[model samples]
Target: MVHSSDVCQCESFIRYEKTFGVTHFYSIEGVPRTGPTNVTILNITKHSALVKWTEIAAEDRLGFLQGYRISYTDSSRKKSPAVTLNASVTSYHLTGLKEKTTYRVQISGFTNAGEGPLTLSQPFSTPKYDKGELEGFVIGVCFSMTLILVFAPLTCCLVIKR
Candidate 1:
């Protein structure tokens, strides 16, 4: 039985008084015991990265699973808004990232009670963008193809007329 003063501001938990004026806490809706595991961050491009992780085990999720929160920041320590995904999501593509930068990402699950603990941050690095190299390769291929197309037909005609 709960008394008037026994209930705390957060209804999920209650504080009750015992003998000798001692207080004890009890949980009605427990949060997850641990964060998600097997978190992986892979850089897919200079401006984006892919994040994937396994969900928290059923036993650890003490309440209804709402979703997962992903927090990421670059080496400069600039804070970015966290992305929240539904519980069904296991993979996410993070865009608008800086090129050739190192970033750290952390993941955690949440429920009606609140967010659970965050996993250890994992580091990933984006590759540098070099447009010149790609452009040069494309231009070279187009030029070689144009030359072959022009010369091959003319050579066949000349040999047939001989």
Candidate 2:
């Protein structure tokens, strides 16, 4: 026998009838209601980048938080390997990336229940090679070639005169 008033007043509950009798289960366990906030990229470089985000609020995380999941894709739309971070980690450093390429990243919180909704993908571009270092190498090579062109002929003429 069951009545509306007899139901447990919990945030969430389940009721069922077994072979023996009626039973009720109550639990607050659920996936996070909202994704991480303030997702930002920093310290972008030729081959690496740093990503950070705010943690899900306590009230929003309905279950025991286990960790976070990060997914990224490059401009070519190829998905990179997803990363899972500890619950205490609010930032991550991505590595082994191509220079001057654009990437999009998304983050979501996971609990004992499952992964929550993902944040909108955030985009960032890696920096290209440094021009100053390349220019210096080119200049050094040109100077060495000029010296060889001038000195080689002079040395040959002196040897012929001898």
How high a TM-score does candidate 1 get?
Answer: 0.65
Q: Compute the lDDT of residue 63 as modeled in candidate 2.
A: 76
Each model's lDDT: 0.83, 0.86
Q: Give the root-mean-square deviation of each candidate in angstroms.
A: 11.2, 10.4
For model 1 the local lDDT of residue 136 reads 88
In the range 1-162, model 2's lDDT, one tens digit per residue, is 112135455544444522345443326578888889999999888899899999999777877778999999999999999999989999999999898899999999998889999999999998786446668988999999999999999999999999
- The number of residue pairs in model 2 that clash at the backbone is 0
Best by TM-score: 2
Model 2 CA lDDT for position 35: 88
lDDT string for model 1 (1-162, tens) is 112234235644436523345343335556778889999886467889899999999778877778999999899999689999999999899999988898999989998889999999999888776446678888999999999999999999999999
Clashing pairs in 2: none
